[model samples]
Target: MTGPLITDWSAVSPYGIGRAAFEEGFRSGRTTSVPLENEDWLVGERADTEACLVPGFVIKEVLGKKGTRAMDRVTGLVVTTVGRLLDTTGGPLPSEDPDEDTALVLGTTHGSHKSMVDITRDTLTDEKPYYINTAHIPNAIGNASAGMCAIWYGLKGPNATIAAGRNSGIATLNYGRRLLATGRARTVLCGAAEEYTTDRSWLEWHTRGADETGTVLGEGCAMVQLRAPAADGRGDDDALAEVLGVSSGITGPDGVAAGLETVVGNALRRAGIGREEVWAVSASAPAGEAGRQELKALDALFGDLDPLTLGRPGQIGDTGAATSAFQVVATLTAAQDSARAAGRVAVLTSVDRDGALGCALLRMR
Candidate 1:
């Protein structure tokens, strides 16, 4: 079956808001990093990791006051990014009519970690158990951002959220693909959002060692409009790339090489293509051990082919749940640019901390 098409996309990252800034950063291979403050309290020493944060982000400017009073940063990012997608597409997904056939499916790792922690801490520290403001309760759940978008944007179709750790982008795209294939929705907004909070940085440092001085913790949101190819067999000028297929599997770190090879092979087989045909790969090979294992796997699979790769997480830092989505955005940017001839065919491969190896194949049309 023909897969969905990525008709439009928008992103809000540390580099800046909107897709233009993100694409420029990817094209130039630039890193947006700044020293994070308050790390001494958490790490007991000067924090090693730099941070990439969305500067000057104000939810009141985007959504006004009443509704955003309780909104979390993750929700704000998704809402703003999707708002941009709507603007770029000229409101293709009807916002007035609640019955319009549009879906919102998002992916994230520890989606509401910060928000949840805040409310819990409040509940405990307060003198009275009920002293905690109940308004903060809604945004503490993993699906809060997606649910908030559905309500705020009037998207009345399937509103779902997945907590697939770092493999969320792959899961979200495949979920949208299924929705299109089954005729469940006319269009789907598939994306992921993550925020860089002090708690998150501390958690990353304690658990994953992701906050080491050289490590950069990046935060952002990316969303793409996905739908079946047009009936006329032609897509709009904004069409970035055609989704071919997605493959995902689970394995331990020791088995990542073997699992990745199998996942890549399966993705290619599903796309009815071969290794040589894949001109480039947008890899999630962040720095350190994960990057090494991923490179070893790629080398073993394609030998000397050495497929052109794009967007190492070090450039954007460790984006967690939003990392893969950013990779997709980067790949689409390269594919649509005239200079990258080999960008015609590309694959997105990621290995999440949960031992999930995911791959997605795409071709510029």
Candidate 2:
């Protein structure tokens, strides 16, 4: 059973815009985190003053003034990323003939907490109860970002948004593969995005509660284009990697290590691979005990192999739903240069504090 091939990809990351910038910053091994400025958005007291943000990413400034007056941060990141990817393919825009077989699937924890909170606040504080800004109403929904991506680019295929917390990336990839297998779509764009906002920051702070090592928030979007494998299983000449297998499960707080081990083992087995075959590994590595338990599970599975590990959280901070998508991108970036990496296997794993765990296997082309 050959898997779908990754034909093209793009990213709007904290490092900068486009895939090249992300690759350069990732290879340089420098952290993107910077001191937070006291902007109007950061309206209240906060414990953390540092974050990893997409540099100079204003919606209208990046995507132009038209049709962007009410765009939220997450929607802006997604639209910008998908546009960069379409540019590589020389695809038609919304004004031109659109590809009906090309679909989109995006993952997120929530759409835009800032937009939602602001809209609610206006209803409570404004002179009239119904004086809320209607322009922002669309951005308050969880599927708003994905919906805007479809309309902005004329993607008329199966459009959907998956909310799976931090494990959303792997879940999105799996869903895209199913769309290809079922003949619902010939091409699928799979990815995830997260936005940094005061509302999100405070929510995270309350969620972390007593954890001393608070995870710094980060914002970005990463997208990859997928197509069915060639008849001979070689896939496209420019294919970056082949999706081998994906597995996920829910484990309560006490069973994090055991649960992750089960999912990773299942993914490897489905891919017809052994632990020793993995050339590289990447993990979400969220801060605190959950992160430690995730590492424990991986160690129990691949401790002896000692493959190359790419750690993104320490550099990019906690990107939430985008974490696993960034992990996939990081693996692709590292495998691009090495001849030894060709035909090798890479494993990506993620665990959320609320008990979600997932693992994915990718075979380099």
Candidates in order have lDDT scores of 0.78, 0.86
Task: Give the Å shift of residue 269 in candidate 1.
Answer: 1.2
Q: What is the lDDT of residue 200 in candidate 2?
A: 92
| Candidate 1 to native Cα RMSD, angstroms | 3.5
The true-versus-predicted C-alpha distance at residue 173 of model 2, in Å, is 0.5
lDDT of 2 by residue, 304-360 (tens): 888887765437889999999889888899898667678889889999988999998
- Segments of candidate 1 deviating more than 4 angstroms: 38-49, 88-96, 209-213, 235-238, 252-254, 338-343
In candidate 1, residue 168 scores what lDDT?
88
* TM per prediction: 0.90, 0.95
TM value for model 1? 0.90
Clashing pairs in 2: none
How does model 2 fare in lDDT? Answer: 0.86
Off by over 4 Å in 2: 38-47, 88-94, 252-254
Can you give the lDDT of residue 114 in candidate 1? 71
